[model samples]
Target: MGCGPSQARVLSQAPISSNPDEFFPYQGSGPWHTSRADSVMQPRLAKSGPASSEDCPPVTLQELLKKAAEEKGDKLALKVERPCPSLGSDGGAPPAFPDEEWKAWTYREYYDESRQAARGFMKLGFEAFDTLAIWGFNTPEWLLSALAAGFAGGKVGGLYPTDTPETAAFKIVHSGASVVVIEDKAKLERLIPALAQRGEATTRIKAFVAYGFEPEAQQSVEVKGSAKPVLSWSQLMTMGKEAKDSVTESSADPLELRLKAVEPGHCAVLVYTSGTTGEPKAVMLSHDCMVFETRTVLNLARAHMGLCAQAEQERVLSYLPLSHVAGAMVDICFPFVATATTPAWVTIYCARPYDLKVGSLGDRLRIARPTIFLGVPLVWEKVADKLRAIGAANSGLKKKLGNWAKSKGLKNSKARLMGGDGAAPFAYGLANKVILSKVKAKLGLDCVKFGATGAAPIRVDTLQYFGSLGITINEVYGMSESCAACTVSTDQAHLWGSCGFQLPGVEVKAFKVDPADISKKEECPRAPSMDDLGEEYQGELCFRGRSIMMGYLGQPDLGADHVREIERKTAETIDTEGWLHSGDKGMITKHGMVKITGRYKELIIGAGGENIAPVPIEDHIKACCDGVNEVMMIGDKRKYNVALITLKAVGANGETPGTDQLDAGARRINPNVSKISEALRDDVWIQEVTAAVKSANENGKVCPNNAFKIQKFMILPTNFSEEQGFLTPTKKLKRPIVENAFKKQIDMMYSSSETYVRYED
Candidate 1:
């Protein structure tokens, strides 16, 4: 997402609305209100900055859509490659990428569709302030449902497509949603049974709408307790159109009235946290919060890329899970914000659900060729691996030339990070022209002007790998609570490992705290007059900005106990003073960049009473060893820390772990035995990994003290997969789950004194 057309303001203080709730009258016990409403959603101005939330032209998603429709009516807003069942073989999966039919929707058409959907929702018994929970993959229907829910004056939430039937039902029940949108008939069938099993939760549902299916594919799936049949996408649209036409000119349309009643301070979206530690909490984000974040992110684009002013259209690929804040912001909010508030407009291309995987994504990228790209660390790693395999196939002189160019590109990239914009070598231009440009073109990233990586910590090797090929992957840091806009790395300002500087108008500080008692804050950690790389100020990173979430969703009507629990959870993250304490431990550099160290909760305390952050140490090992795909430290109560390592392998579907075949780079090391199961017994493979671990331990950059070094290591038979519940949907390692699953292997490594231990078959 890029900045809009608003001029940069030079105000000393953030613009604050005197009466925040003046626009919307408070309704009693509704989905729009969260626990601690009096304090949670209060308007908080930035301590100091030029950007202000009030500067955003539109206050709500509905308003933003309307503005875009009025101004950019003829501009392409969305594009989708619809799967063709006719071209499928034997009633299996849809047609291949080449045979898929593409469709485009203009800004005006997008708005109209949303408006009609909103009317249909009202016709289906949806009321003002009701919740609409969308459970689907990233598609045109998902976006439309979310917008329509907002347009109909309702709070919108999403359930990850990866969520199980139970998890989906839990979110629907928790949100008190009157309607749920499923991607297709099969998923709808699975969900209806789960909802029916829930005694009270099932009663809340009024309708189940299914999209991405033909009318004939829509089955008579119904909850056991109820007789309501599943509504098809076309049926919903027809209902909406009839409702719209029924409204005479003399009478006010109910949908229009709902839209008019929408307010800036009202809750617009509910973003659920990953819930790694406990049950997921629904984070309440106000319309004001979303608008502010959209503007701030866009402003950064204007500052760095000079976007909005340009005539060229920004092309963005919408592939990430729409349930996540990062995904929703980039794909949904960013485009609308750009269209409404800035001269720049974005055309979004919807990707298939499986497009996040390594092999399948390339086909979609070739079609979309997005100008803006953002991916999680795993996504970036896959792309790097794909490129590596391609390079490994080149022979003789071509290989030599490619390696030479990569060296120059890598050097120039590193220099650029050190503020060496004009320090490129004489041969750098030639390298870009002769090799790097062609590589980017082949990968369909030639059109990408801006690229970023977030969600989890990325490997330095992955960054350098992309840098070597003339692509800079800027790291961004934010969570659901911050509306996914806090700090970002841009071309103008960036650090090697840091998450980059704080966004304009977003204030960030490192507050001092006791490691044993993180809640006991003492004072602000100060970074005095220091050098360029000085990181003297180390503490918990806290953020304060308009983009901060309102509060976690609370069921006030449920009981006093439920309300108290919600308040307790909300208070743990946000303080009375309004600083949202990110559980992450990091520091502010003298240069004002934010560098994350590790999670406070994830810190490992060894038996020797030394506290250590495992992420850096684990990342170091992965960086030193190209074959390793995952690493976990296991010495929370042991004498020394040990690592559980899994080698990269060829996937059956570019996602799930399948064959025992070792990945390309790993196979090169032990060509005699390509399978991981056999490679563990190979002397060459074992020795290489042992040497890599030793190098990682001796690297002071990651392991500052001797205790932090991994004393021993064990190789797992398989990589962590989502199917095994070892990895989250976003591809982050589930530390507790992994530890529990591999307890026996971890125990064996500690019991043995060998430097390299093998997992028992």
Candidate 2:
């Protein structure tokens, strides 16, 4: 796990800032500097191994919550908001001003509520290690129920709200969850049909818990043929209270007994991967894995930002779907751990409570002003697009001033990359004080010191553009199996287009693969030594560490057989040696930074035997056109690569609207416009797309043999979406699904008599 000699050399040559605080391992005494064992937190396990005391802390969610309640009982732990009907309601309609109320819970109250829910589970005959499925948004109740399951020594699995009834039922049945906590009556109603469809397969589920509605409201809701009873949140709590009251002080509390029995290696959570190629596999993460990831992330953040006493002042916005590992870690695990160990941190849930304008993240940012912001590339892309559009719409002096400010910002960013502090230039002070400040305020990024992007590869130009604005976005790399813990770019050492160094306690290596071996599945080479590292060493990225998951549920021996089965279905694997073969073709730089090139399974092999990585081509095309949203390169065993492009639908104001808004508007314009391909017949959109592709082909970097120059392309009528099953929940393109869905369109491009419509360099 130690850094290689080359890595050491690279680190030694990195620039040292005059202000040491601005550099790595910021020279400041912080909470993390204190002995972790003495932080008044202890592992929940009764016994620890020799190395466990010093390295792996046997911590669990139950322990983290209990410690937080003990340390900061009266402090605000959560703020749940809900929209309410008006007092003088017109048939229970929403208020004129849209009335809303906030429900604040102290740490002790939250803990007590969790215990009550745990007691309720016990009354319903639930036992330790049982699975409880949670299906909802990032609500306070969702957190409470998840914690309750943990308190009862049960594992919790979350389902994406966007998942169809069939998909949700499949997970519920597959995970063997006996209880399901749903968002509301509507969500419960949606599940019933799927349950009936599933028949006996869903018989394992004994009960359904509903929230976001009154007890009377839940009583009216019914499942046609389900033997299980549906209960309201309050009813569950009431049941828990009654159960707790009946227990004598002489008897050990059921919740306490469950907590005591908890072990670090026990599966605490099941995060199902967004099964793009096939059925989703439930990734079983240990309590220790989650705790380790939290601590490691905290340590890195503190070192990079010099955050000593400011840990308490940090705030994070929880808006991403909690089903994803990134969302669960950020919104649940990080805050819980921080609250236990630091002076108190706040987590703000940004769902229905604030009457947040759908697709208007700008408004949410302004209000939250979170110190730490995490987003997928798509979110950042939209922000950049909006800023660019606003600047383009400006006229005369305003436009000139805006351009000057941007130029100065870009200059400052470049200066920082060359080892200077990212300070605004003297000539740019007026712009920073006026235009930039206003813009930051509007975007609610004024307080942001650490920004991160992950789940998908973002365009390098997009990252550079944000850096020019003085917001350095660290591109993080991880997967569901790692508990979303892997490489992360930091303020201390970051390179453009790289996913930075491996996380502490984590080890990564790249292996060489023969380009001609199409049948050979991507695997960890026998000799994965760093001595073999070179330009030609680029292959599959493999990682192993404490933060890695125990294994996928139901798959005990993750041997070659298991790996081969997974590859057969999804073209991904985790070898028996414990290294996760990421299937992602990548290379580790001398500096230890990892750069992902493309997916091995998704790589295009042309008829001429050229192996082309599609990602670079797609990114280049995207950089060249504002009108294009996504590009799927198609040329597997074909003469040359062609692309299926999805156009960005523009609003009446001449700016491309958000996907949701655009889809709605398109439906109104013409119902058939549901797919982006249908709208590709537009002459203007066609011209813009063709020009973008041509420009990419001319300017894009490519290997001698692996030329990514697109000979032809057809614009698609529809954009890929999670709802359409063409994308993962995290917004990554599902290659197999996309190809299958657009097979006819792909076939048309190859069969049509379109000649070499290529642009000359």
Question: Residue by residue across 1-761, what tens digits does model 2's lDDT show?
Answer: 01001101113212222232221221232111111100121222212221133544667878988888898777666764455332233222232221124566778988899989988876776677778898877788888888888888888889987788888987887676778888766777778888777656666677888877654534543333555667888899999999889889899777788888887767778899985677888777777778877777776666565332343545667777788999888888887687777664555545443222235445445555777789888788867877776776689999998888777777765555423454557776676677776677678787776688998889998988886666778788989887895888667667678777777666666765445442343443322322333346577887755667665665312345644454443223444344566777787654456778778888898787766888877888788776667888888887777787765553211112234223322333344344454455544445666777777777635433435688788765446676676778777888888788778777777777773222111
State every prediction's TM-score relative to the real structure.
0.91, 0.83
Q: Model 2 off-target regions past 4 Å?
A: 1-52, 84-101, 215-226, 353-357, 418-424, 428-430, 513-535, 555-572, 650-684, 703-706, 755-761
Model 1 RMSD, rounded to 1 decimal: 5.1
Clashing pairs for model 2 are 675-717, 675-718, 676-716, 676-717, 676-718, 677-716, 677-717, 677-718, 678-717
**Against the true structure, candidate 1 has what lDDT?**
0.76
Clash count of each predicted structure? 3, 9
> Residue 261's C-alpha lDDT in candidate 1?
83
Deviation in Å, model 2, residue 681 alpha carbon: 4.6
For model 2 the TM-score comes to 0.83
